[model samples]
Target chain A: MNEPQFALRIRQHLNQGARVDARVAAQLRAAREQALARHRSEPEAGLALASNALGRLGGVRGLSLRVLLPLVILGVAFATAVAWQQTQRVAEVEELDAQLLSSDLPIDAYLDQGFAAWLKRRASQ
Target chain B: MAEAARLAIALAAALLLLAAPPAAAAPEKDRRWSELNAEQQEILVPLEGEWDRLEPAQRVKWIGVAKRYPKMTPVGQKRVQTRMKKWVKLTPEQRKQARENYRRISKVPPEKRGDLQRDWAEYQSLPPQERQRTAPKKKPVTAQ
Candidate 1:
């Protein structure tokens, strides 16, 4: 019989309320456990790119989404962070240099903070 | 199949990392000392010795100053050149300190700025030993 009919027969057999010996009951429970294990995975979900990649490759056996998802996420985040940091560094240097070059105060005025403090003290006194 | 996907992702990430260096470095490579215009090379002469050693952003900033060089007053232009010459000689830590000092001083009132300038002149007039005594407290420049 096809799978549906076979399943129906097994269901009916179990519902018959017949008493079974210890060995047969244990064997049935083990078979059900194996069946449940086979059905452990849900349908593939999330991130069309990731899912599509696996789908196209006929899906990898036993590769958990739990691990793969985080790997993709962390890689993307870290790369983005690195690129942003470099750009900021370049821009900051450019603006600071432009301002320093354009300002009226002699660069020496800028080179020493203690001199500025001295100027402040001189002004106060 | 999922394993292949992981491999593909890793390869793609590797490619992205590989791609970043070329983009950042390509512009720097293009800014070789030989590539600068005659005027730029002249205006930035002070940097010539260390031009290649400078970061790409440094070279770009100096080039900008050269472009604006003609518009500035003679004194302004001279000041920029003098400042740049001294700037290139500074260690990175000293540069950081200079930047902090500049930012702080820029905020002083315009009327009071004259006083600060006069004090600066007086400070410069001090003997070498006196100037050394007045040196700013040394603070290590931490990377931002």
Candidate 2:
């Protein structure tokens, strides 16, 4: 058939309302059922997959350390400061102790009120 | 390879965190004679010439003494300055002897120190001949 005639015949048949033969009709029904079954199973499988992902993320193993990092750094800084201050204090005390041990006169002679009184009395005498 | 790089970065960060404290905790470096602040320099002016030769411990002690200088009464300050000058002039042997005497005297009980002081004073008050005759016998220095 000529191209115009063939195109006219296909359009007329589409407009007239076509029907499938029994075998083709059965095949179409089976394909539709298979697609619907696959569609139904897909949603359930997707939900199960999402649930598994959420479960893994909800446990302690999934916790992030970033939240605690600042606290850890602050604690370290404070400890360092305290240790440095303690050493400075110890150096001061040791210096004082060494001086007290090395002086020519007794420490009590320098600090004792009674000794000072005697010195005054002897001077007067 | 990317995961390994991330792990290495994390480990480096952790090591930095661990090392930071000790690095900061180390005592400040020994200061040079010229590095003393205005106040320290003023207080330690007497030892300026000998500052370079002083041992680290001696310098530390002197710095501590300088820090306490301003708090002292004028009389106390004068006495300390005088004593420091005397201490500086002493030979090492004389200083050692003084330290021995100091340590030995420190051990005497507080109550007994008064009696000892009285005896020493009375001894000093006597005539030179009597003082020499009454002088205590020499004894070995006590170990601290």
Candidate 3:
């Protein structure tokens, strides 16, 4: 028989409460009873809802950790670089200022045209 | 909607990284002569041809001096420019001697600096012949 005819005959037989071998019938009956018992014992909708809510919270926390950790590291690195640069610049400025102020020439003498000739004359002598 | 917001936040975070200026790859202390900024370059222009030949300490001093140049008054700036020109003309030995003399003078107490200034003024007022007579004579070089 064709596939449609075969299916229709099986449905009609099942509707008529057809009997199989005693052993096969017993096994089928036990399987159906077990499935119904499991259905009755299944978890409540409230319990499932609570578990889902906790899972969502955990997901958000995981997301925060993933994003936040890198950001903190980057921030620290940037701060350290800036601090180091500022310290270096300040030290440089201080040293240069000391050199400029402590020099013997009073700065203006170095600019005097006559001083150059004086230095040269002294050196030549 | 919540997922969309989280995604937007993540995008913002990523964009923040993109928007920030890149940190200097090398420290300012390690900057080469060619790497100097325009202002520094202009201020130290007389030293440009010999920048690489300068010692690290000298380079640092010049760069530091240039950095402070903008803070100086017009007269101070003019003095610095003239001094820089004079400094560039000195031989290495003369520069070294100048630095030593500066260090020695700097050690004098502030109150005593005036006395030193007076002595200098008296020396400056002496006649050339008299000044030469009092000046220290160089040791005559002997043949090996």
Candidate 4:
């Protein structure tokens, strides 16, 4: 048969098939709706077949470390600041110690407040 | 190979988390006198007798001092060693006062410093009664 004749015959058969029993058509319509709903939902529903949202985040590590990272960073930053402050204080002390240790001024001469009073008196003289 | 790389990354992350706190906690961490490098040990030798007795923070400070030692003039180095010997014997109150004196003295002009130091020496040589007369009057001693 020629192509148009073949197409016309197929269309006629489809039209006749369309005139189905009401109950059967209703069943077919319900099935088609169900299939359409599933197809529309395929992408989202596919994930459920694998695992939940939490599990897909590479399991426990992702969950724990994501939560753990910010907390640990905060703790470390605070601790490091404290350590750096203490280090700065120590450096100040060290510089002072090096200075005082190497200076020509005697410790007794340095420490005597009366000596300062006496020096002022001598200077005024 | 990919699995191994992932595991290594995860392990490294865990280790980084574990190590960070201890590294930050080093302010109070102690190092033995012997743990000091040769230069530190040699420069810090004067403190050896007191090393084990010193606080961790104090040891850290002394190590810092030692690190700067090589740059000092020979006389300055000798003076440091000599004064450090005496320095360790001072009470905390005396040390505090000495530091106060240093802060004030350092601000004096270089030329006047010698004169000031000489005056201090002369002032100290005065008889006790002479110094008493020269010194600003203190609050009268109360009967115990």
Top DockQ prediction, candidate number: 4
Q: What digit string (tens of lDDT, one per residue) describes model 4 on residues B22-132?
A: 654344346798788787778878888888888676677777777678888898898888777677777878888888767766665555434755767777788888877
Q: Candidate 4 overall Cα lDDT vs. reference? A: 0.70
Per-residue error at B112 for model 3, in Å?
4.8
Pick the winner on lDDT between candidates 1 and 4. 4
Q: Worst 10-residue stretch by lDDT in candidate 4 chain A? A: A60-69
Give the per-residue Cα lDDT of candidate 3 at A96. 51
Stretches > 4 Å off in candidate 1: A1-70, A122-125, B1-30, B37-39, B53-75, B125-144
Candidate 4 docks with a DockQ of 0.24
True contacts preserved, each candidate? 0.30, 0.03, 0.02, 0.46
Which candidate, 3 or 4, has the higher DockQ? 4
Ten-residue region with minimum lDDT total, candidate 4 chain B: B20-29
Please report, as a residue range, the 10-residue window in candidate 2 chain B with the lowest summed lDDT: B132-141
Question: What DockQ does each candidate score versus the true complex, computed on alpha carbons?
Answer: 0.21, 0.03, 0.03, 0.24
lDDT of 4 by residue, A8-111 (tens): 99999999999999999999999999999989788646545444454556564334443444555567656655666676677677889897777777677777
Please, what are the lDDT tens digits per residue for candidate 2 over residues B1-144?
Answer: 643654565566567667655654333345678999998887667778888787675677677677667777676565566566556556656555555454445565555445554655664576776544423347633569
lDDT of 1 by residue, B66-134 (tens): 766787778767777777878877888988888888776666555654665676788888777776655
| Candidate 4 ranges with C-alpha deviation above 4 Å | A1-80, A117-125, B1-29, B115-117, B130-144
1 against 3, candidate with superior TM-score:
1
